[model samples]
Target: MLVKLGVNSGFGAKSCIYMLASSAVLRRQQLVIRCLGVGGYSNHNINTNQKPMQGVGFSSGASLEADVENVLRAITPTLDPNRHKGQAGNIAVIGGCREYTGAPYFAAISALKIGADLSHVFCTRDAASVIKSYSPELIVHPILEESYSVRDEDKSFILEKVLGEVDKWMERFDCLVIGPGLGRDPFLLDCVSKIIKHARQSNVPIVIDGDGLFLITNCLDLVSGYHLAVLTPNVNEYKRLVQKVLSCEVNDEDAREQLLSLAKRIGGVTILRKGKADLISDGEIVESVSIYGSPRRCGGQGDILSGSVAVFLSWARQIVTDENLSISSRNPTMLGCIAGSTLMRKAASLAFENKKRSTLTTDIIECLGRSLQDICPVP
Candidate 1:
């Protein structure tokens, strides 16, 4: 006896098992099921051979790649003549402290170069002037304070003030890239925690990178269970995350499985494990973007990635319901990571083609528009 089951969409665990059993028993059975699309199961010659049946549905990997170019093109909004300012996108980067300011500047500016309508930076007082001087296009806020500058008696008042400052503009932002040059200052990290919580409440998407990963690694509750949150961790950061969450070292052979489990353990927050081929996972599915990038290994490229992810993530959210794409099973955060990583690599590759060993973060950022246009043209 052979049974056949046809499914239109992908099969769940229970449905998959049922189809397998039916195919084994009824050799000449055929069943048509309605899923997301039209796919059926058929078994021939069940009398002599009783073999386990194979189930076929859309593979998550296939779905991701199938729509990569389309997703990139769709999320990239067109430059309409009727559209005014801020319609393209408004991005905010939440990092930059005394020790480092270039990271936040790289992140905020990259958004604008990638065609975002507005880009803002929230940084410590010591870092604000430096970042502002780097680019007058960004709206820099010098509201954050380090503990060294605050009195013990004024900690509570100062904390509230910082929170208030961030809260004022939190809602207006489409997405926030947390941690670029964010140093691990106790006071500053504390304020960032509040800001993260507020962004959660406001339902704003967050892309965590650099020291932001450090902050979240220590305090998992900051982004845990938030579907809109994305974490971009380099080799060291990924190792730390694996150790912190899974209590084990990195397993190169099972990288994709580990990334999937890590995302699941973090309660569905998306993660982009940066490496030779960037691996992205959103708890349920794992995908890789292996487009060849620059070999220069510049310092601030991750900052560019975080900012680019923020813009793409914002754009992805805008097109979520535009079409019933086969890739809809994956979260938009995961899609954004895939598209952002691909674009960054293409830009880096293009920049490296010209600059070779001297390909800096700025050089790669300069190539973003051309790289994007190459992959997905406007007209």
Candidate 2:
């Protein structure tokens, strides 16, 4: 029993921990660890991914021709009963304002729908109540102040309060989805800057989208050299980022090279350029997820991608660190982009199949679970 306890404990576990080949074996191992007072074993191991073990792989294509599905299946944690809340993931979105509540809602709720345990939304006072009304599952915090609401003298005090509020919960979050419906309020953006700095200090991973892209574009220093940061940019946003960082136009002639340059220029932060084919880069390799997708042009799909990536990215990081999964692509952000983009496209296709041309973002969000289960069914 003492021998069992020692191995079951965190002590001398990692070597064998990474070698648990199949989910069935992984599950049995997890249960034994939990029952034997080896709480740490269960952590960073199971309760990620979807349903049962597929014992199968996924499809793919990229600059490196990555086996996207294989990587997805590999890093995805097996769903185990021993895991508890927040172990799967606790994601926070720092976006939403009077003008946009749905973006944040879509991002936050999508995180939960994708299997994140706790999803929090921190938005402006005007947007908080509306977002809360959208769903009771979110832990909405009305803590951000817009430029129109604050006076010049109160800026400093308000900034501190804003940062303090976020700092209180900063370390608790595994990943932050910044700028879903986040408006371009100077005061609010400034406060967000402080929050981003604090998150970086805490070593928290961040997925930036929407207005977060706007802020990071204007101030490249915000995410420069921070490998944990991920930027998801649509067409217009990508143009702005490209122009600002590379000081050049979007060159399809050398699209992959340009993306690699852009990521390298940004000090190796990951970039997911949203297009017909989502291209992902971490300054090292350029990968693409060009699976079959819906032709429907929707407004909020990017928000879903951001939230999805945040959760998957956190999981990929955990699994990569803890389990020696078969991933040639070592960068967690890249793995996340591949998984998030692939899953989003797959869900979008399924939603379009059902909703046809009227496939809205919510429809796509609704398809997330079913789509994942279809690819990797729950046992």
TM-score winner among the candidates? 2
lDDT of 1 by residue, 1-379 (tens): 0001112223353234223333322321221122213332221112322222122123545443334555566556656554445546689999999999999999999899888889999999999999999988999999999989999899889989989988887756778999999999998899999999998877788999999999999999999988789999999999999999999999999888888889889987889999998888877677777768888987999999999999888766554433334443435686688779988988999999999998899999999999888877767
Please give each candidate's TM-score.
0.83, 0.85
**lDDT of residue 161 for candidate 2:** 93
Give the winner by lDDT.
2
Candidate 2 residue pairs in clash (backbone atoms < 3 Å): 51-378, 52-377, 52-378, 52-379
lDDT of 2 by residue, 111-223 (tens): 99988999999999999999999999999999999999999999999999999999998766878999999999899999999899998877788999999999999999999
Deviation in angstroms for 339 in model 1? Answer: 1.1
Model 2 TM-score on a 0 to 1 scale? 0.85
Model 1: runs farther than 4 Å from truth?
Answer: 1-67, 328-330
